[model samples]
Target: MNYQLNINWPDFIKNYWQKRPLLIKQGFTNFIDPISANDLAGLAMEDEVDSRLVSFQNGSWNVTHGPFDSYDQLAKTGWSLLVQAVNHWHYPSTALIAPFRVLSDWRIDDLMVSYSVPAGGVGPHIDQYDVFIIQGLGRRHWRVGEKIALKQHCPHPDLLQVEPFAAIIDKQLEPGDILYIPPGFPHEGYSIETSLNYSVGFRSPTSRELFSSFADYLIANDLGNYHYSDPDIATRDNPAMILPTELTEIQHIMQQLLAQPHIFNHWFGTFISQSRHELDIAPPEPSYTVEQVIQLLCQGNTLYKLNGLRTLNVADQYFVNGEQLISPKLNITAINILCEKQEIHADMLGNALNDKDFMQLVTKLINDGYWYFND
Candidate 1:
């Protein structure tokens, strides 16, 4: 599933990104689905997977959460099965995301795969995040409208749909075609035939989200607790009224926490690098011994990073699964590979293999299910 997109990255970002919707015909030439409909269904049944079954009957839209026991009761048409973060569970689908790394790894949310029957759709809706929808399997009629102020209503408790807007881009997308929709745009897709569509969604964390995350960080680290001490006791007319100077001083205490770029960078690096959805992590039944893992790596075996495992670096720090790995043992080359690639084979060892401490760090990762090595 090596994917290549036919578009100019800089121009697309400058002109169309978050500005308007663009329909790229044959975005991936002669595209093939990385995972089949049947395979997607099986993944949906797994308890750890987040999935949904959306069906429209007569005039009502019904939303059902999964792990569903059966889809047999669902109507033959007007139904779609959507599995979120499919890349976390499906290996082939993970490679489909390579081309989109241009959108910063931390901002990319996940690959959501939907299998739809004829006349199936989730209804016209607006999202807060940008998305690139790649048509797979069969044809789907997609209509995208510009970002506008529209009234919205909740047809189903789980779904908030917008009133239809005049479409700016409407067309029947064949396999390999892609429809890029920016955030806040009203858009809808109607299945013309049985189809599987892969959506690569980007994450735009709101101020609320960052505030919540940073607040938790402060509490966890016991920071910014400098007491409000009035060093110069001023004779105030009313003791109850806190002076403007005192309030400004209090604000600076909190502001000082963010002023040090290193502290915030470390906190953010760990925060954004964590997967929001349930990860498909399975440590070996009988975990491999350190020697066993090291031997495999030395023998030219690959250590495959788990899908959805967030490995990243900030400055000289390396982080995996939300915990920064800080050690004198950690070197630049090894950290770079872990942060950049999904798979690390023996040939990539370079000088890291010569360091015992580096090998041990990788072994610990394998045991934690962040990575695995084929025997």
Candidate 2:
């Protein structure tokens, strides 16, 4: 089932987006759940999928990772199962992400679905990423606390949670209800009955992630070859002691690398466009010819982007999945369709077919399972 969301995009962004928690009752009118509890359980058993089963019984919390062979031992109640990146495998869940494109594209993460029995929930926790939890199937009582530094604990290695904070907003969410929580807001949802919830999460890299990835990029590319040398040698009382000036110089070197906006932009463009989760990419067995692709386009068929493949448009450059596609000889208007539209229309192809580079790039992407004809 597809949801026709009723959202005030400008107002939502101006007021509540990333600033605070929001609850939109009946966000989707006459809404129908797209996936079921059985579907979620089935997905949790897949090897490539990220999944977990959480249960709290008799004041003891148990956490288990999957590919679960069986869930027969899990209690009928007090257990919740979560499957990550559902959008990558399930086409219907992907539709739930479209309305949120009003926000930044690179920030968009994957859809995670959860199934819970009555009174079941993962403990109170804080997420660094922003998320919208859409209630489906049945009711869930949700509580969101203040966005502050709360003390966290780990009962199990896999589960990290905060002590229950005072909820600023507490409500029972029914099917079609949407609750938006920004980063660092401690939140928890307990099932009132058997239920399903869809979380659309958005990611922002941490300083540590950026630092480590940038260093790796430098190593892989053999960049930053400049050696540090101080013409003015500092005299120290002890030969073993490092000088303050030298420390400052070392810090400045790293800062310079970070300050190069162009290099950072290129690295980030590739980094953000690739999913942390596995993508459903399997290149075509028999490659489609350029003439065949052109014929399909000429026949007025649209090409849909593969699910979970990220695309970004920065100036004339188009970054798809992880590689960069320099815009065809044509201007930005033609190439903009690559990032802006899910389906690349025939009209948008325009004169790009005349260019070998554009045709080759398109064929390569098609063969790589990044894009496909609507037929």
Against the true structure, whose TM-score is highest?
1
In candidate 2, where is summed lDDT lowest over 10 consecutive residues? 326-335
TM values, all candidates: 0.96, 0.92
lDDT of each: 0.88, 0.85
State the lDDT at 362 in candidate 2: 78
Candidate 2 off by > 4 Å: 238-244, 326-331, 353-355
Clashes of each: 0, 0
- Tell me the tens digit of each residue's lDDT in model 1 across 1-375: 688888889999999898988999999998989999999999999999999999999999999998977778877799899999999999999988889999788889899999999999999999999999999999999998878899999999999999989998989999999899999999999899999999999989999999899989989988767787887978978879988888898888888888888789888988988998989888887877778876787888888999988887776678887898766667778778877899898778777777778777777778888898755
User: Residue 35: error of model 2 in Å?
Assistant: 2.0
Give candidate 2's TM-score: 0.92
The lDDT leader among the candidates is 1
Pairs in clash, predicted candidate 1: none
Predicted candidate 2 versus true structure: per-residue lDDT over 2-77, tens digit per residue: 5688889889889998899999999987778888788889989999899999999989999999999898898878
